[model samples]
Target: MVGLYMVPPDNAVVLSVDEKTQMQALDRTQPLLPMRPGQIARRTHDYTRHGTASLYAAFDVATGKVLGSVTQQHRGADFVRFLEKIDRTLPRRRALHLVLDNSSTHKTPEVTAWLAAHPRFTLHFTPTSASWLNAVEGWFAQLERRAVRRGSFTSVSDLRSELRRFIAAHNKYAAKPFVWTQPADVILDSVARASRAMRINSAGH
Candidate 1:
């Protein structure tokens, strides 16, 4: 996994793909207080739930560009459509190396058939409960901090619009290749230790 980040194959594009599911379209009950000198912005405690959106996003590791879509459901069909969108965006000649999580939608027969047909595309799933390894997860964190969190959305359409605008701005100005600093051995050692501790605790129990 570390090697995939640090030293990807030549002529191949690495993409970190994932979904930010069930994002609420929340409308604040009261108007928010504007920020003033020596004071932070404040939002209303109460909110109305309009609906939810499922965001499927892909981050190009080489160019740091983001490609995303908002969907009502996170089914295998939805995932396949997202992958098709990605396929259309990328160059045909270059191989696609996608790093994603082991979600059920990802491994479904529909997704499998699509991958089989597109031989140039490859998938690498992150370890269970370790989605932090996928670079796209960091992008999701940024989206939450800068766009979603504390923002008021009266409906699902409003939320989707905000997300699209945020992604556009990010790709235009903030996009940059993510650098992997930790060595593979160091990461492996930490994982091993954590696994050992878990095993010991389980045995004790």
Candidate 2:
């Protein structure tokens, strides 16, 4: 029942964790050139089909710092590895409140058993089908549009290196903390309006 505005103490850490799936590891032979005015750089329409990678990200709300990893698999072990990465990123003596989706791997008996031993940590899950509540979702969306989309890499390691570099650059200019707009009732009203419009269109059809 942790609320979105529940701020972390100065000595504690709050992390929003999420995993992005089916990320293609594409290879483009041509270098990405800058486009001139009224012109666009052209590249091959098709890309070499390399394998996919699972990217797990963790965002610290207080510090605006993000830690992430691109893994070959998205199993429970990989998820555990991401959690460990979060631990390494945060201050050691501090407590943590982790916000995440309720995936099977996240809530499995194995993960639960491990969590039981870590009393300093608390895991909170977003409601079903509402993972947008996790701030890391927005972080991944930014990473996707800015770096991952339509980009090329020579190898898996090359892609990882590029991601690491991009992350470092992003951290250099991290913006203000995210501000949630619109009150709950206003959001619900918007949804209701959309639903009414949909009903009207359906009746006409």
Candidate 3:
């Protein structure tokens, strides 16, 4: 809920947690043309795909600090490991309240047991097709624009290293906290319109 995102800073620590999966290592066919005065930067449309990597992250809503982990596969086990990493990184006294989407992995038996064991952790799930409520997605957009989009990597390992470096730099320097500006009613209206359009399209077919 929007209220969870808007919770007071002094309250429980709110984290927007999610996984950015299958990020590709794409090398442009030709070198990119760097930007100058009047012209914009450009790159070849075609690319060579080395492989893909998955990133699990928890973005602190109040502090703008991120706890991240990279994985070769996106699985419930990996998600649990990331949760354990979060549990270790954050201060033991501060309770964590996570905003997540309706991903099945988030509710697996492993994750449920972990949450049951850790009373300090709470979860707030966004409605279907409404993950934009999670602040982590905004952080992800920054990663895409600043690193992954125009990046050139030869292998999945190289890409993973660069991703880790980016995460480190982000916590050190780019603590740009994202504010939730849209009202819940506005978002619900948008989703309603989209659902209607999809229903109309499906009925026509």
What order do you get sorting by lDDT, best first?
1, 3, 2
User: Candidate 3 — which residues are off by over 4 angstroms?
Assistant: 9-11, 34-39, 182-205
* Candidate lDDT values, in order: 0.89, 0.74, 0.86
Sorted by TM-score, highest first, which candidate order results? Answer: 1, 3, 2
Residue-level lDDT of model 2, residues 1-205, one tens digit each, is 2344344566777778888887777897666667889986656656776777778877777667777787888888888777777767677799988888878989767677767877777888766545666888888888888778757976777777767777787777874465557676665565466557757777999
* Tens-digit per-residue lDDT, 35-70, candidate 1: 899997788689999999989999988789999999
Q: Against the hidden reference, what TM-scores do the models get?
A: 0.89, 0.78, 0.85
What TM-score would you give candidate 3 relative to the actual structure? 0.85
Return the lDDT, model 3, position 99: 89
The best candidate in terms of TM-score: 1
Best by lDDT: 1
Question: Which segments of candidate 2 are over 4 A away from where they belong?
Answer: 29-44, 184-205
lDDT of 3 at 38: 94
Winner by lDDT between candidate 3 and candidate 2: 3
